[model samples]
Target: MFRVLGALTGTGGPAKLDQEEQSEKILSQAHDFEVALQAMDYVLDDHPGKGLQLLEGSGAKPKNEEDQCVRVLARGVIEFLEATLGFEASVMKKAAATLSEAQQLSAKRRQQFQKMGLKTSSLYPPGTEYAVTFAEACLLHALLMLFSESMVESAKALFKLRKAYHMLREILNDINAAKKKKGSAMYAQGNNESFASFVSADSSTFKSVDIPYSLSTEEQQNKELMELAENVYNMRKKRLEGAHIGNSPAIERLRTDLGIQALKDLPKKKEAKKPVTLSKAEIDKDQATIDEFIHSGVNLCFGILQVVLSLIPPAIGAVLSVVGFHGSREEGLRLVWRSTKDRNIHGGIGLLGLLFYYDGPFQFTDVDFDVPATSDGLKKTSSNDLDNSTLLHPGKMLEDALLQARALFPNSALWLLQEARMLSSRGRLQEAVDLMDSIDVSGIEMKQVRALMIFDRAMTLVHLHEFERAAEDLLSLLDINEWSHALYTYFAGCCYLENYRMCQMGLMEYSRIDFFKERATTLIFDAPNMLSRKKFMSKNLPLDRFMLRKVEQFKKFQSQLQLQDPLDAIGVSPVHELTYFYNGYNRMTEDCLKLSHKLLTEYHNPTIDAKEPNQELVKNLLTSLTSRRLGKVQEGCDMLDKNVLPQIITLQPDGKVKYIKKTEDPWAYPTALYERALFTWKLKGLDGLEECKMWLTRAQDYADDYELSARIGMKIKAAIDRLEG
Candidate 1:
């Protein structure tokens, strides 16, 4: 592929790279590639063992969903690729059959011309004339539409090897350009907040200063390093026979062609391809890593993808890196997967692995997930409470955050958590949960903040209807040493209460509801702001009125300025506010279809800019939202696609989507289950009616569960009608 790219360069490629050899640069490039090769260097690296035991001494485990996601992704990629290739593990035999049939035909190697396909044989008479055509080549490009994926083995390696080099160059260029424009833009010392972090700030050091010469030199060096990697990679690409299982040679070539010497002193050349400038918005949305991976996968640069993708499973990481398959990843993976031996083979299995696991890398855990900021945010005034708001920071802290969230690195967990919540809400729960779970929470000092984390989980689970499982989340949490966070106590109480309620609902018994309510009152007193929250609320539970009552109560609470835990206090609140804004926009689309109007007045959300919630729900949301949106009625059902139903439950990890976070988050459990249920309800048809009847009783396990009732109610009714029929 490197060679092909080199050939394409055609006298106008890689100028800076044409320059000198420095031992320092060579060592750096080698170090980078070694890291890039972790996923692909299976030859040198031992297979990572599975299970908690292996991870006992290994720090944190990959987590259930992350591990499952990779395996699933490997499987899915294989399936799609096989289907596209018109073969599975045994397609070679079929192709061979055609070759044999071509030999037996006497009409100059033609096989029944009009009915069958292809024209190739050595048995026809020498002078015999048979029409030859290249018609199929047209579709070969289209063939790339199938079986290609970022998860393909080849796709991954190319990505890591090339992408890392590309990103470094890009970052260096940006730094250099920033320095040239602003002056004194170097990273060394004093910039860090902690004095200790300075590691002894030296007056002569490069810290707290930026120099153009140093910046430009850094970019110049990076440019050369990346080009070198691209060149060597392309060199091996030109020799590819086809995309399937046989594309192993190029990987070996990638490993061998670019040695330490080649990286040392390479020649300068012309522009490889004119660089395209993009806006900040565009860059933020671009999944360059994913795009490259897909490209490698489809180009039969399978050896490349295999290596890069090995760093992280494509199923879980593809979306994070690229964004989507149809536009970018599909072509890339298809180019390689379709060209492969078969899906059933090791290669095929690898491809399928790409498909199923890319989105998840997360799984269902016994926990509660909630977002109190959601309820709180709903109560804020129209004057934009995020600005100059003390609910979060004190004095100058608010000022600093305002300057940061809008910038590149916010250094705020709220921002990260908000991102996590949005992903979970979209139904990539596993990914969201994985990210939240992995977050470093030591920086958090507020007890209320800790509770909010628990709330995030409780809400996710409530939506999922994992009644007993959701309730169990509070047990361990309540028993923990640091269970003092107000948000934590509230959510844990909610989870237990909701779980018991769900059990009652499931059993259709009024007694359990009463018992759980009694249990809930006892736990509420333990909440951080329990007395304040219940000061004057109605005696009747809010769940009775659904989301409406909760919305009204929060609104009242906000109006009085009687709130203890400010809405924006957690740092992540503003980000959560953004999510609320988007949901408001999505609601309008829901209004168009009249999906949910049971809440208060028909409020139009200004955030979505009045755009439709799109033609369809996102893949992450599809499975989770389907049952509630589609319903069992035939007329209402016409809006659904049969194939989509199965696809929804197909179980994608957060690893499949572009905007997803790289680590685990606590809010994903319910989100994943909700989506799984969407798929399940649609496929179950008549059986869902039973599940619907018990939804409300089960929803009561949580303190602020008004929203859960609505979600479950919608799905249950729709499910019962569809499945029970």
Candidate 2:
């Protein structure tokens, strides 16, 4: 009968099954599931090629639908990773095709099971597993489509994501319904037994497994068994004492041997174990195996979808909501936390997702922090307060999760990078850099992870004011990946420019100043041209576009002054202005902030007086930022309102129509507005909540069509959400 079922289900041929397993053992669908998990384990261990090889070897010619689905899904994952990391159009196309195939196969299997009225061995209804896999395929495919250059493809991706969202909701509903039914059945069964009988039965069913003696003397084995028996005897004696049962002679003797002084000293009664029949035990084992497989996959995928959708800027999120597509970051984080509880590949991915969110976007974009109460009033005394604040603090959780991941995959460099990021967030800049440097990416096949390590280390160095070394690190990334060459080049240029400023300020040797100046000019001039050559999905990235705009502004400034060097024509440090977007200034040391302030004030005063209104506006904007970070909140606010905001907006005589001022650097206006909002929130606490929102909303409105507008919008949304919450 088993052979015939195997043949009909296409799980395996009769001969193959006979050779693979004993006739008494039933074949399980979990074989392919386990294999897929092992493949992921191999990848996490820094053996990505071996992982792909194993998957291909097992899934090349799958005999069953489940095997085929796992195979195609794994293939799609590899392709998606390559495409995203390398930005290869051809690889992305292949990923799209593979995911589509997986989706169709899962759907077909689900329909076949439903039509045949088949019942799964587990508690879930027939085809439920296939339905979950189908939803996963849909979500992956939608995510891949988002990288497409075509507008139509983007629209289709949104609809597909919506479909997957609804499907996951339905699957969760089915799981809840099944759980309720099982609960009701269990409750009904418990009602049939008397309370005394139930308690006694549960106590009697607590049988311990006997360990077989191996390669040990009989005397030693006997000693171990005797120890185990004594422990069990004492446990039962304590239970009897807690239950207030009359102590028989046997119990009294056992308690006497255990050195019990008084009956009142006995521990409280433990909760009674649930009694299980042999048949029910076997059924539960099967149900639990399948439950882990299904629940982990569903929660991980759903959580990822929610988080990605929640990150969309409000401008785009509002449009998406009009079409019934919405997401909550809080809800997504909760679901991801659930998946992390399971010991599976999905759980690992969910853990990494949380780490990235907290260390990356959450740290970079979130603006809320607790202001220290000084004698005068509330004020932000140190930039370090941003990470130390109690609002949504994830430091403890991050540390615990990183420790767990390191224990599981000691050879993996990815977790080490996350550890370094945690260190950086806690203000240990040098330690973070050291930790990142110690990560050996020699065995890791994924170049993207390598690129990330370099980028992160360079950013930390920037915070440490090691500009020359940071520039070298950023330049090294050009050889690693093609995802964003323009951005890398632009970053290198900014670093060199910063080094030149240091030299001019007598912070470095004056001899290398000319070399740094020339290098900075060359890289900045070349950055724009690199963007035109390196296009992903036939479109420039948002950051790359921002870089191009800055380069254009620099060219115009240089031409107006007819200076041989572009840096000579600038009033404010472009690198410092650019760092504001990345929240780099928020991590600066007191000494670093002072040096930056001096660079802006001493060297830029002449340029500010060069009949350039935009130059003066931007100078004040950056100076205010530096001043605020150095514990001068009121001074920063006064400078912003007095010198920056008035220049950007002039009041009309009628007081009905506001005249807006035009400047070459339009991004500075909205960014200044955002800074003002932060100032209000710090000074007034909850009292100025409405005013803070007003400033943020105006910033968002004015951010339209400006450089880094999307970035500004995201920060504004995060701030507003914090206020409302």
* Each prediction's whole-model lDDT (CA): 0.29, 0.63
Residue-by-residue lDDT tens digits, candidate 2, 414-521: 767777776666666787787776656555567766777787888888778788888898888888766568888888888898788788778789999989988898
Q: lDDT winner among the candidates?
A: 2
What are the per-residue Cα lDDT tens digits for candidate 1 across 27-47?
A: 232222222222222211112
The window of 10 residues in a row where model 2 has the poorest summed lDDT is 206-215
In model 1, where do residues sit more than 4 Å from their true spots?
1-28, 35-466, 474-515, 519-631, 635-725
Taking all chains together, each candidate's TM-score versus the true structure is 0.24, 0.76
Query: What is the overall TM-score of model 1 with all chains considered together?
Result: 0.24
TM-score of 2: 0.76
